[model samples]
Target chain A: MTHTEAGRYLRLVVAEEAPRTGDTPDSGARRVWEIAFGLAARRRFETDSPLAEIGRTVTAAVRSAALPLLEAEMLVREALGEQVPVDGIAESVRTAVHLLVFARLADELALTDDELDSLIAQAEELAAAGISPRSEPTGVP
Target chain B: MGQTGTLYTAAGRLLLDALGEKSPARSLSHCAGSPGAVRLLRELFTVAVRRGFVGRDPRDITAYVRDLLDYQSLPAGGEFARQAEAVMRSVLGEPEVAYAVSDRRRFELICLMVGDLVRPPGVPTGELVALMRQAERRAARS
Candidate 1:
């Protein structure tokens, strides 16, 4: 419905769920990111394959990269244990992490292990080839 | 008998419930924070799940957004914007779908109903179907 109504509903749901665990921030971050990653995967690349091990691999990158940037990663663990309520602080943290990493790793399927091994080669040919990133814009004129 | 535990241990139902449970609050402030920014959007999705509006296809939503944007020749960021814009225009023209759902669930309902139009990815051929068949046989054994 309206933006505020949804927020109200979210608070109620979050209230019912157990708060996040205090221990193991790493797992907590990992779990919440998993949902954001799922949303991004569904909406971004249009592929469900992102739900598999490869998705997990990509998630591992986003989560580990973001853990250092977050302060409440541990306090938020229990909140993360539930599906991240739309209103929870963990939801924002998780999505912010996904946005940062997804911007870099967007065309993930195009990246191969072999290419990653040789950074200089890939970096040099970044624009020359296999969809590194969108240099030229589209849709908006 | 074997079907009882199918989605039982899985987080899918939990995720689905979260999607269904709450709608985000609205505010005029410029920043409700990061989760705040997407809170409304996530509620829309949860409603979608509750209504069975979303497809069972496993692609995560972000990746779907990326691919759909790329395909539409729209800037990736513009993808959701475009959809939101289009839906607005459609409602202005027709206005029927809104009546079918509660106001709080509208956005999520849209995502559920139309999110699949973003186009699904190629399947890994018969790989999964074969696996399912084998698993079914195993389940039948006991």
Candidate 2:
């Protein structure tokens, strides 16, 4: 399939998966920043200008899923190191897993804007307090 | 992909039967004392805990695995090695190598791993396969 076809397929897969993950959708500055920074880290460019805000929004979302977030973080770190193709099957597998979980939860739980804001706020406080490895699951590294 | 006919071997068959859905093999590594079994069980656990539905579309999964093969390693040919290298740099993960595989390749690898794990301990193989089958069926039903 062409990149456009593959890319569209991926977006659709992610869309279906987003509902599975139930991630609360947000357009907050923080969310924008988080996605932006993430894209930049991967040497990706996005139309969204305020990456920092997107980053913060995603941070709150990450803090909430704690365990899954870490699982995903490690996977991506591993993927980047491996240089998995952008639209390859493995990338799809990993990305779908994360997107599904977060998106489903975000959509299903439907946390109020204030509730989400507070969660992020709490997460920020925890960060300030140096809550390292928040809820780290025990396992051999 | 070198199809290790290991699954057809006595040990491999024992493992496939053992780790089947009926019994849903419990950390076979615990008593089996086999690295292969340990790895198999580990894969099962990771796959279970992480992926919700094993993806009803097996073809999609096969494609995903095939895409993965492009990442881990390549055949010792100029045309092939270059492509493999490109994939490795872009998409594959650490575990991808150990399971370094593609579509039908994944089935072969999983079969080999499971076969190896359940072979030594024959009795447990039967028991475990039953368990795995059950779990898989349940997952499918859910």
Candidate 3:
């Protein structure tokens, strides 16, 4: 899968859904942020922490109505100490987030099993190349 | 089943009606034009979700937010917006969780929450009350 494959897949899926009722322009980017935060939470806390546990922590931060990202970063840094790679984690988080968000969206859009497999393969290729999914233009314009 | 059982029941019908046969964006655009609709939409998603509106669905609310932003001509994706979306999605996905706040007496509870989140708080108290009355009447008729 080339760097643009996952995005292409998303566009194809979006084409099937109604344009006006489709996902937001920033859904892809938002998913990136969510993924990064989730990964940092897991790494900063227990490596084996259940997804639900990390999800709870993330949810609490978001509901604080305060600075949620700051709160999440603070929590992760406090747990992982000062040496955590904030930039590196964020870089890797972009791809991870895209993978997670698209996988769910695919299901919601009723993409076939074969289509899902192809999308995952493309994502894996992007991740393996160390190419941040954020580098891809979201075509929002 | 909180203290405002009657109000919630009435409000639920109103919400369903407001959303009837319209995409979330279209519905929100209609709300954007009316302060009463704005108050109801805001409260139903923010306050009601926190106060045990079991019917709350995050995907639906996300679409609501997306449309509301479009209605206001505000940018859709920001850190806070994304985080808020995640919060709604997480809360709705969870099962048997406790509410964050409970205030049946304050009918304007949603107005306050949404006002703080968005600017130029939409009061229109008279309008919202009228809308509620209309909803109650329609509910009665049905």
Clash count per candidate? 50, 57, 0
Q: Write the per-residue lDDT of candidate 1 for residues B33-116, one digit (tens) a residue.
A: 333323433433334333331343222232344454455554544324224322332333223212323443445324433333
Q: Is candidate 2 or candidate 3 better by lDDT?
A: 3
| Residue ranges of candidate 1 with Cα displaced over 4 Å | A1-48, A52-54, A67-119, A127-141, B1-48, B53-55, B58-142
Question: How do the predictions measure up, each by TM-score?
Answer: 0.24, 0.27, 0.28
Native-to-model Cα distance after best TM-score fit, residue A35 in candidate 2, in Å: 14
Tell me how candidate 3 scores on lDDT.
0.40
Residue A136 displacement in candidate 2 (angstroms)? 3.9
Residues B1-142 of candidate 3 have per-residue lDDT tens digits of 2114335443444454554433433444444545445555544444335543346433344455455455556545543333444445444554222232233312232332233232334335554444444444444443
What lDDT does the true structure give each of the candidates?
A: 0.33, 0.34, 0.40
List the RMSD of every prediction in angstroms. Answer: 20.8, 17.2, 17.0
Better of 1 and 3 by lDDT: 3
Docking class of 2: incorrect
- Residue range B21-114, candidate 2, lDDT tens digits: 3332332322255544434343443343224223232213223334334433422222232233222222222232222334433333343333
Best by TM-score: 3
Question: Model 3 Cα displacement at A24 (Å)?
Answer: 29
> Candidate 1, DockQ to 2 decimals?
0.04
lDDT of 1: 0.33
